[model samples]
Target chain A: MPVPDDRKQQPKTTADAKIPGAYEGETVTRRRFMTASAHTAGGIATAAFTLPALGMAFGPVFEKEQVRWEAVGPTEDFPDDTYIPRTITLSPGIGEVGKSTVYVRRYNDTIDSEVKDEYNDYVAITSRCMHLGCPVRYVEASERFICPCHGGVYDREGKVSGGPPVRPLDRFYTRVRDGIVEVGPRYSLNSELRRFSPRDPGQAIDGVGQYLYPSRPSIRKLPGT
Target chain B: MAKLPTTSGTRPRGTRAETTEAPATAPQRNKLQETGVSTIDWLDERTSLSAGARWMMFRKIPKGTNWFYTLGSATMFAFLSQAVTGVFLAMYYDPSATRAYESVRFLTNEVFLGEFVRGMHKWGSTVMVILIFLHMARTFFFGAYKYPRELNWVIGVVLLILTLAMSFTGYLLPFDQRSYWATTVGVAINGTGPLVGPYLSDFLRAGPEFGATTLARFYAIHMLLLPGIIAAMIGAHLYLVARLGTTAPPWIRAESSPELREDSK
Candidate 1:
């Protein structure tokens, strides 16, 4: 559409508004150029703003699968008591690495005959807190794991009792191959290898494998009048 | 010069135009020595830039104001410091069972400046955490969080939480015994919430329990995720600080002296 003669005849502002330049015929306005430049800059700014988040949000989606573990301990030597604090070194992926300690507790209990299998007679747990990560201390007096930072407490079975921790303690995979005990990746109840194979009855160990303690009989035989 | 036309359609046929110019009415002008107010007008017309605006939006800041503010800036510096160090570490960090431990060993022993840089980054995180909290406390005690500054306080709160989360997430990256157990407790706590507890726990670990996936998830979150959020929050915080203007010294408002009032009067 052609502009009307009267309106089209009006003088226009130049790109630099403060100074008026003489134009014999047509002229441009400062506002028009500013608007165009601003739009272009805005487009550039918007792209700059959105690209980084997009890159970070999607970059790791197709990363390779990694699964590995460090040997925590041998089976028979750990004894039937709580495993003390110790770090296990492992390489999880090509360049990835980690160190973790295994907490295992074994006590005297009769094994059910129905679930007997060849694995091992032991249970191990990892002590990492699920909340804002804090070292959880196993309080012997309370028989619960307690994190001092946020006061997160867990029951003897590693179940959450209180505080900000978000989940139960993780358990490591344990098995007896030959006589040596080894722990695999931390496993759960729903893992592919179902529940750990049950152990045989204590009597099946045959007395040869049992170690007799001098304190046992002496402690029982208190001084008599 | 050409004679001016009275009208194109109706002009007088005969003589040249006469100058009746209204006798150039005597000009009325003020000449009362000018009051020397020319100085004031001249000053106004000069259009010199206000020092405050010039100093604020540009100009090099003095060393004095730069002193205490360095704590916050240093806290930011430490974060960048951590990022550089962390990147170096991520190059060697393994988020799995097999390589996680070895990679840490390589970082600690094999890589150049690896141990020192990692230690600095680790310690820097602690310092950053402490400084951020201190900055918040300073802002609070100084009443910097009052009035128009409330949004800054709220953003500060979010940043505080992000800092703690960063620390928590970073703790697990080492995959140490302490981290493992700490993360377990972390997971268990999430499990205790109403409704989606179990699902949240599973989701956090990326499975039914902590595994290779959990380690990977945590590494990504710590290294790549939370930092991004923190950077945004910091940018907002600094921008707000710039907009709100720094809190002034209280003595400026006390106004106790009568002489001062009289002087102003």
Candidate 2:
């Protein structure tokens, strides 16, 4: 046979070079061809099985904004300066609809004098305790919220007053629109008082220091504390 | 063509003689065979899958390895069983504290084959744990962790830890009273550790106590984190095993040892 062109071609380390007759003519057998097609089909089927599962597992990450002002009826529904505990159905996100008890207290006077605006008009405190997740009961007579799980106590303003709670009671975002009151998502007090001093117990409410210490007379505290 | 010899008397009743005969249409058969061959060639050009498969399946293994060597493979089989069944069970398992119990009830009572899948996931986990322990014992007794296999041994230990973590986290996903109390105790036990114990316990619970966040955190770890870690470790362990080849049994090692021979002499 005549010498083929590129007879002195450089050595190829590619997979094609290693596989016999991989680049040669008439290399595939019927069985081998079917097997290869089956393999490709199997891979596609596996991806089909897994990709949807992965998407579903991570579906919450792509969910629309969960915190929105959901109307809780007219302003008359919540009397001025009175703590009214109401169970409101909240749709926080897609496929997440649930009822939550919120203590709505409307004050003609600003509850916290420092921040003046819509917050002065109303406050909606979530029943969920800041310590553990036990629902806090509003003790109207005591003007406080007490957690049955840990004896955590929060004042009317939702500030941590006693028990095991490390921080104040969590509050829901609230707004007054067209003589109607609406509540949004619950948020921790930690972010609002992030700039407060950690050392001083008095500044605990102003700072996030309250979150650092277990509630006073806490049975759960370490030995040194 | 010459007829091949056959035991005519032993032939099954009603069996067609044409089963042994050639295809009626030789040209069609030839065309079909040609198409198959070309398809394989087309695939082989793009991917060296056949070469890789041949290397994997036909690699030389030392003689006298025997069926005892199958424990590790059995353990791998159990792990795969757990993964597949766990995926199916996850479809109906709600991670929320309030809904989790209800969801599990729905899965077991209402959904078709959900109970079977759940049972498989539960029992597969138990089987995986047992198999891993047995495999480890076998490896230890055979002295397979020696020399070049040390890293694989370490990786195996890491896989064991991850597997245990997976089991522990999965225990809490059911949101039953038993799971709740058990997990609380588990978290409390972690809290008893020195220094970082409290912080670690808090992190695991996602707070000071077990509740919704605890359930969510445990669900995440069980379903995602531990599986990911275990998978990577398993890959490394298998790669090392393939690279080093399965270690010979202790008797074989002792028989081959020059020092042992010299001592005997």
Candidate 3:
């Protein structure tokens, strides 16, 4: 449908426009220029405060967290055959809530599958379930970690033996400092026990899962682990 | 007559001289009533607030409007109740992670009417959720969400989500065992989403784990962020409601005018 000559749209620029005030040299009207500048100024002013507030709020996402090593107990306390639960503060200053239970044991050569490494001198499993971060209790009889909130189960090696866990249970860097076993920063494991950057619970860092749910910058798995 | 605050010269001071049977024409201004009237007039003169008030209050609601129509107002009142109670509760309720549980315990056990106010906020949250749902159902069942009112429906849905967010964030304020774990699980559930999930959970917890500021974050979001958005959305929702009038119930079929009937015939 061809537009009629009378009904066609007007020119965009002030110079091209046929209106009385539109001069040949004027590309834009004063009103439009004022409005645009005012709006730009308002937008800039808004972003000035909004961006920083948003940055402060989201700063944790990109901010690297401190990796603090705390000794739980002596090496003799945690037997390789079983697990010992020790309370460790993952985040400091928030009192009891920040404290989490990590089940620690000396690496049993018979059961350990991942390659022998300096960090894994003692096998330590975080109490947070791989399913949804629920605190999983180590049942002594079954030799399995069980989540109470959701029915997730992990076997003796913290591998997902049954139930809803997407990957194996998360593990921490364990070291013997001055004859005492110390647990350090946490790191997640794929089904095959391959180490990757730490992920929140329920994120599967296996196969395509790694790319799909990538590691957060705040806390990454140990450098080059 | 009730005593009124005296303005210097405008009001007649001789209430004793003005008898009960004073003439209607020579109306000696009743200082008490005149004060009230003049104050209102002064305000209305500048703001024209009365017109807006009348416009909002005296809307021509559609026929077949019944008790069901009151659900929106009921939801609003529930929010107002929550806000009032929450403000008072905030006077004593500490947001510090260490003292949150203890503060709540103190509020419940010791402060005067603290239990009652806290209980209202707690129970009122559920009530608000229930009322919003009922209001939504009314909107859905009556076909009020169709046509020009769709934007209002979208606003309403936003409000509903914000309300639920309020519930989610508010759940953690007590900092009890249930709250701590529930938030953990909730934040984890948030992490189950593809691509953005990991970052979102980190943002919610303020780190890879629930850290020092998570409780304060939740509290600020619950009381400050969400409430402001919800209140603004409600203002928009009500404005649309007033502007669009309302849909009659599904049962009430439109009655054609006599002119329309004759034209059809």
For DockQ, the strongest prediction is 3
Q: What's the fnat for candidate 1, on a 0 to 1 scale?
A: 0.05
Error of 1 at A174 (Å): 15
Report each candidate's C-alpha RMSD, comma-separated, in the order given: 20.8, 14.6, 4.8
DockQ of each: 0.05, 0.04, 0.82
| lDDT, candidate 3, A115-221, per-residue tens | 78999999989999888788899999998989887699899999998899999998999999889999999998988899999988889887899999988889988
- Candidate 2, lDDT over the whole model: 0.67
Alpha-carbon shift of residue B229 in model 1 (angstroms): 1.2
Question: Candidate 3, DockQ to 2 decimals?
Answer: 0.82
- Using lDDT as the measure, which candidate wins? 3
Q: Which docking band does candidate 3 fall into?
A: high
For residues A1-225, what per-residue lDDT tens digits would candidate 1 score against the true structure?
987677544335442333456344335555667899999999999989799866544333323223343455565556554445556543333222235455675433442111223333555666555454455777778878887777788776666788765455555555666655666555322112233211111101113211210111101111220
Arranged by lDDT with the best first, the candidates are 3, 2, 1
Interface RMSD of each: 17.2, 11.1, 0.7
lDDT tens per residue, model 2, B1-265: 1121232455674343444343576967876785676567556546866776666676777766888899988989998888888888888888887788899999999999988889988888898999999999999998899998898999999888888888889888887767865675566455444444445565675543343455777888898878878888888887788778887776764356655565544
**Candidate numbers sorted by DockQ from highest down:** 3, 1, 2
